[model samples]
Target: MKKILRLTRHALLREQDAELRRIFGSDLEIIQVSETVPDVARVLAIIEEHRPDVVEVILPHSLTAALTRAGLVIPIIRAITRRVLHEDGTKDAPFSHYERIISLEIVSERL
Candidate 1:
């Protein structure tokens, strides 16, 4: 099983987390850390404890670039979203990340 650490707490992320957990079943393991603190040490400790294969860093205020450049052996995924307004003025295309991330979430939910 692939281990994944999720770093996000936004409404969308939380929704995705729940949905993912519902979809993945058992192929993956998800560990989530808080977004309140940007402390690298604390985050690193959580990552160390989980020992995840990937750390999904979602919308980190100022630490995204730094963490990405830290050169950690574990793969770090940065989640980005695009807010698009429809012709009728409705928001669309809310949460946007790599398809793999979506797949991972779906897989985890199933498990």
Candidate 2:
């Protein structure tokens, strides 16, 4: 069986589960985790323990740098979500646009 380690809590990646299953096989062991501000030791520990063939993660710059320094090359796949809202305070207007929220960056990344 193929083993996968999911390091984020977001459901966006679940949209590809069927395709992933088809590619990997019928049966898979998926381990899911959502960690905020994981230290280098903790990161390596989880990887060593799970020993997954695939790991889906979104880590902060510090953690990423630490991993890079620890001689690991990680591939990244980020889920980008867009919400369109009208300038007049409704989403139904013709001038619908996306507004950036500084607060959601951390929450989104963690998820």
Candidate 3:
């Protein structure tokens, strides 16, 4: 059994919850938090409480900045869809702190 902190918009949470339930059954304990930038503190608090093995951030803008600043204590797995493409065509550097980075394509293919 493992815990996962899900940082996503409340609107998206429902779908995510359903999907997670289907995939993990009862093996995952998810703590869903706000996806807005201003709610970073609350999300951080949830992270501290759960101390999940992985923090799954949905929205790149809000979560990435907050996660970077919070000094996330656990591994992170971001569900990125569009690659972070730079102006010169090289992909932007993926956040390095996470043990893994899960792309939306991968999730879709698997699920």
Report the C-alpha lDDT of model 1 over 49-87, residue by residue, as the tens digit.
888887877644445555654567877765556889889
Q: What is the number of backbone collisions in each predicted candidate, taken in the order shown?
A: 15, 1, 0
Off by over 4 Å in 2: 73-111
What's the TM for model 1?
A: 0.61
How do the residues 1-111 of candidate 3 rate in per-residue lDDT, one tens digit apiece?
777777776343345555555645668777777646456676677777778877877654545555666666566665433458888889864332332442223122444
Which residue window of length 10 is worst by lDDT in model 1? 99-108
TM-score of each: 0.61, 0.56, 0.47
Pick the lDDT winner. Answer: 1
- Compute the lDDT for candidate 1: 0.62
> What CA root-mean-square deviation does each model show from the true structure?
10.7, 9.3, 12.0
Ranking by lDDT: 1, 3, 2
- Reference-based lDDT, residue 3, model 2: 82
Which residue pairs come into collision in candidate 2?
10-111
For residue 57, model 2's alpha carbon misses the true position, in angstroms, by 0.8
Instruction: Please give the ranking of all candidate structures by TM-score, highest first, separated by commas.
Output: 1, 2, 3
Compared with the true structure, all predictions reach lDDT values of 0.62, 0.58, 0.60
